[model samples]
Target: MSEAATLTRTAQKTEHFDVLIVGAGIAGVGGAYHMAKERPGSSFVVLDVQETFGGTWATHKYPGIRSDSDLYTFGYSFKPWVGAPIATAEEILRYMGEVIDDNDLARHIRYKHKITKASWSSQDNLWTLEAVRTDTGEELRFTTNFLWMCQGYFRHSKGYTPEWPGMADFKGKIVHPQTWPQDLDYKGKKVVVIGSGATAATLVPNIADDCAHVTLLQRSPTYFIPGRNANELADTLRELKIDETWIHEIVRRKIVHDGAAFARRAQEEPEAVTAELLAGVRAFLGDDFDVEKHFTPRYRPWRQRIAFIPGGDLFMGIASGKASVVTDEIDRFTEKGIALKSGETLEADIIVTATGFDLAVLGDIDFSIDGKTLDFGKTVTYRGMMFTGVPNMVWVFGYFRASWTLRADMVAEFVLRLLKHMDEKHVKKVEVALREQDDNMPLLPWIDPENFNPGYLMRGMHLLPKSGDKPEWRHSQDYLAEKEAFPLIDLDDKAFVYK
Candidate 1:
């Protein structure tokens, strides 16, 4: 057969759906549930690169892997989280399993199907997706009327690790938390973890007791909220025999209200918020410890995310003498360990780089529209979910300060509403475009570095889509403001182009 004949045969086997969702993580699973419940007649399928559900939970297997955000908000609003506010990865996966089972979403999900390319055809009013099954290496194709991108913002294949001099000369085994080896043993070994972020905080404590001695090396300090993981409102509600669903909703509201207030206070009175956060850490590490040097951050509270240390476990590990903290800049790696710029060399048998992750722009999938390669950086975001010139597609980029699921749930509702509106109008295509007023609006980077500049986001800001001055044109990342504004969004607004 000719090459064209083979291509024609493959195209003939392509499956089609009303909607196609990427990533089977929390956001993807929630998207599926909403489509099933609200748009029961619409045919949709979810594709994930991982072999199972729980995107991050399934990918990360490092020790002490758990949620930094409280589960009440991280979990789907439709489902009640019955466990502790901070849950282990295993527990989270189990909860996700229950959701899949309860909703009968298993049949709709295709695991190990990694989407490699997405092309939008204006003539056909459809999206053609090419995927490969990771397990069997089988090629697959699908077409859909709408595309729902739930793949997270970070690269899951590997974590980021900076190249240090003498790394090849060092005899010790170097590991990254994202790809933890299952058979590697750490018992009685001297371990050093690099980075001051949440990953380092979680790993040092969990491995302290087993290691001969563990040290946390950092270039700068970060803010943390050390507190008990228990939620008092949920406990009281349970004692009073309240329904689990009611408890979930009530506690979720309280937390959201408190979070909004906290965010406001952080902006209005940054000094006070910083002092209070430092005080929380001081209480955990005790007055004698060098909290100023080790715990005090240079930036204001909530500038970057303040990780919650459940039960103050990370601090407890430091206080117990099993672990120690070293705040210094690394000059380079030595034969034995890392050499600090201060002329001090710390020895370690094993080193773990908990630096961070690389941000993934639109699942790193090759995307093209109308035979032209789409440059996302050239488009302005529409409420951070949709892009200008992008039709019949929605991407779920969640909150940084609040639980990610909160925005996921909101976006699900918005997408459903848009779909229904399109049906009513008998339109086959819908896209966002700049209105006359937006022509002179100033375009800026996706996010302001001063507001929330994490390493991953800062490094990848150039690759992200731009934002406009108008509220409708920017992502905002403010859940409180979006909560009120999203519901009032007029589908027939001037910016919306329908055909």
Candidate 2:
């Protein structure tokens, strides 16, 4: 197909929804489950760009892809992962499929329905939407009263960026880790991965045995730390049978909240404790290697994403001569290989541009209210769940300090409470004021786009919280406080306008 032909064209309208949850990921499904449970009278539906549900799981099928965060805090509050603490990509996908099956959410979801735009009609308080089906190339349209977009940080499918000029000039076969084809064997191929985040770290060990040599290229360093959910915490919880969900949630909340506290403290004053931990990585790397330069980052420890150190697998890969790290800016690409700013060139049979994702804060949807564009840039996050001045919408973005599900779980609960309040009070719509009151408003650091080095739309930082701000502004990134703030019995207030 031609490149122009590959571009999505919007279709005409057909269906309607009381609530339309975009991107059928965990957040979208979780919100639907809550709505069904708390306010059964409310009509809802979810749509995914893919042919099936399980947004992240269904999309990213890379080799050795798994959660860097422990499974204890990653799974749902109502549903505890009964298998393992750390899970494989396939395992997580299976679990998500189970969530879809158990909740009977299949009928509510329309696969291959790629939503292109969501425009809110102020006069009617409804959003007219656009969609395209990949299989048929058919166009369609729909409408919804409210929208819950859980598209997460990445694009909806397997995307590798050839954004850098001269990418096509490279003589070597180029592959994006996100779009890793199962049939394209890397065995005995000299491969180079051009990225420095979690994906890069994880990809290193997975292809080591197959590749003749692999090089990880990075523009800047990320703070690296060891992580995993190796053991079976799930079996222990089941054996106890003490309200499995309750105990599971409690433990998840505890580990995430407390562990983040430790990480924060470790950052503010590494000498207080984790100095030895940093030293551990340095010692493992040895004196000849400049650990402080290649390993240590410029920002405070967790300011950016701390690379998940998988029990020294990456370091061991380097030490074993199977892999090497190259910190340099890419000047351009040549037919033979990639040339760096430092005038160094690396020859390779295959190249992997793990070069970050193209991020979409609100999933690239042109959202507008009453013909007035909902400039996401102009709004402050109200509790990180709802945006100020945006009406009848709830977005669930997780935490960098803790596991993604920790904040996601809280956001899900908060959405439920909001839905319940709407149901009880007979309120059809809810809107937040764009302006702030006094010094209470906070400009959080959670929305930093550079944290993950993902696609421009995939980075979920800068959307985070800051200290001393209201829970509306200050997302504590803590579990207990978030839980309390989320499940409020009476959410009606002057701040939250109801109609």
Candidate 3:
């Protein structure tokens, strides 16, 4: 072959690593940090489809975008969050960037590498990944001993928007918050926002003053905790001259403890919890406003996530008459706006669909084991991290009720321990399988609908892996229980097979 041909072939050779982390988002970055810190000198690469880090924060550019959870818990344990409890997207990006730069993790990451396929070869005992450079359209190949899937659970290309009749006939521009257009002007425009979730809550308050008239339209209301963004404990600690790191740990523990208690109260004494939540809304909306009709949810609190609105901003917007709420199903879209089932028409110059996300199963990548396509739905989840019949792979599916990074940090620690155990035993492969005692364990859906049934999960539940009756086989979303249980798990359990 010609020297030029030889050079080209060499350039396209498959790169190999001890581990390949699939994403540069919060979970992915956390995993990478743990590997670098605990397993120093390990060969690992972090690949992301986006041009930079901060997965959700990087891609979402909608105005007033901020975290629904408090930063003390949402932030990593190793890092101290000195900002407000609720932080904006820019603040989050800056925090993540500091983690990368401070840890010198930038060298281990490759941007714009979108994995298209992941094939596990039991004979070779490695995962072969095929990816395409989204920016350049160049095919790339890599082989890794372990695959850490942390690409997140939503389709970033588009947000979920239910189709309504006469959408094509509408004269006004319809936009989804996931892909907000930068050039689109909304100044003095009469706007209508659909959906009552966190996105709507955040967007309505931010855009209320800019729009001529804004209306928040929802089919059913969702629960929210409207309060000041400050954390009193952390503020007190700061005033006492306590270190930021110490403050972070102290405040995180307090929040987690309080959150667990609140969750229990919601489940055990839902009526009281419901009354307390509505009262908070009444405080902002006053007795004259219809809080029961506008803010009361049909389901109990914590069935779906209860978003936290900093300083009750959304309620303030409504009370000021800058924004209004309409509780009714959409009959269809009208030329000028939306037609409601209550025989009312909301006129608008622009419409924003604040609907939920389209859940992505295993990053939506085509996965196969030994030349056979893998159906995640058929396999059982092992503690919601590892799956039966999948070798040398661990996915970071974080907690829904708590800060996502809490579980991400826990999973990272578990991964480090597992890797060390494998090394000490001189094993090349490891996978979780059901023990004999688990043979008759009933298989159930990923999550029980009664416990938590969000729209995205309900829509994509079929695509997720099944869980068993035992705690070893299910994802117990209870953070407090898992925090105590994870560290005590025996590495030599019969469920783990090594070779």
Candidate 4:
């Protein structure tokens, strides 16, 4: 067939839905479940680029991969996490499968559908999406009145790795944790894991047992707090023969409240919290470990995410001589290992770059309104869910300081309430347009640069939408504050415009 003919046929093959979701991860799954429960009659479909249902859990298969936050808050509010507080990737993936099966959401998800662009039309009162099949390379199109971006804020293709000096000169194998090879073996080999974030923390202890030795090389230290792998409260309830439902509720509430209160304390009294956190580390690692030289970070606690070490496994590995931590700058790659600026050399058979992710908002999908391209940086966020001048669209960005699912649940509730209100008013379109008075409100980055310490977020802050000083414009990172704000949010606020 001719190119023009194929294009015409592809355009004719467009499908339509009442609502369209752009991912099948935790956010997408919960958003779909909530949407269906709120508006039973509405037709919707979730389009995912990956072959599986679990987004990150399915993709990241590195050793010792697990949840950074406790599953009580990380897991959906509607679902009960009866397992350990921190869970493995396999366990979490299984939980996701259970959620999909229990909710009957499998029928609504279209896998291998990579969305490329989404355009909104004011005259037609709908959104047109262009997608491609990964296996076949065939084009597909879809249309919907409401677009929900549940794809989390990172690129799925690859993790962010810096270009080191003379990387190709190294003789050893170099691998990124994001795309860990299934068949690659590291047993009896010396492995050097780069970066000091959660991935590095998890990788060192996990591979330490199998490998001859593992070295965690980092330029700086991250705040880490030793925590139990299992939730004692949940375990006690189970031992007492309490019903799972009641136990789930009690444990979830307790974790949520405690997490919120602790975060507040960290932000309000960082020094006290920092001292308290370091004291626990000292207790575990002991006086001879040189905690100040190796573990102390320049930033205050909770400014950057506090890495949670379940059972103090990382420190235990270091103390046992199976693993070690080196805090110094990497000068370059040598034939067998990495060379440090301090004139020290470390040998390794394998190198794992546990660097981080490349933040990609809205799945890097090109968005346009009324045939005009939209610049996200130029626009402002509406309550951190919707963006100004964007109509019938919601972006699922969670709290950085707390469990990601906490804010995701709130966004689901707020979207459903907004949809219901729009239905009652018989509104054709709902846009979050900044009023004249809103222009005077000082606009700030979605996340203040000085406040958070995640690498990807800090690098992509310029690409994110702006926020104002007011409640309607600010994105609340506090889970407890949002619990109150989202429940009593004013739907009739001047920030939203209906037609």
TM-score of each model, paired residue for residue: 0.98, 0.85, 0.98, 0.97
Residue 404, candidate 3: Cα error in Å is: 0.1
lDDT tens digits, residue span 128-226, model 3? 999999988988889999999999999988999999999998999999999999997999999999999999999999999999989999999989999
Candidate with the larger lDDT of 1 and 3: 3
Clashing pairs in 1: none
Number of backbone clashes in candidate 3:
0
- Cα lDDT of model 4 by residue, 1-499, tens digit: 9999988887789899888988999899998898778888999999999998788998898988998988888898888888888899999989988988887888999999999999999999999999999999998899998998899988989999999997999998999999999887999999999998898999899999999999999898899989778888899999999988888889988988887788878889988998888887888789998888788888887888877899999999998999999999999999999999999998999999998999998889999999999898888998888998898999999888788888888899888888888899998799888888876889898977777768888899889999998877888777777788787877777778898
Q: Cα lDDT of all candidates, in order?
A: 0.94, 0.71, 0.94, 0.89
| Candidates in descending TM-score order | 1, 3, 4, 2
Best model number under TM-score? 1
Q: How well does candidate 4 score on lDDT at residue 484?
A: 82
lDDT of 1 by residue, 388-434 (tens): 98889999999989999999999999999999999999998999999
The residue-by-residue lDDT of candidate 2 on 290-329, one tens digit each, is 7766776555555555655657788878878899999888
RMSD of each: 1.0, 5.4, 1.7, 1.7
The TM-score measured for candidate 4 stands at: 0.97
Clashes of each: 0, 30, 0, 0
Better of 3 and 4 by lDDT: 3
- Per-residue lDDT of 467 in model 1: 94
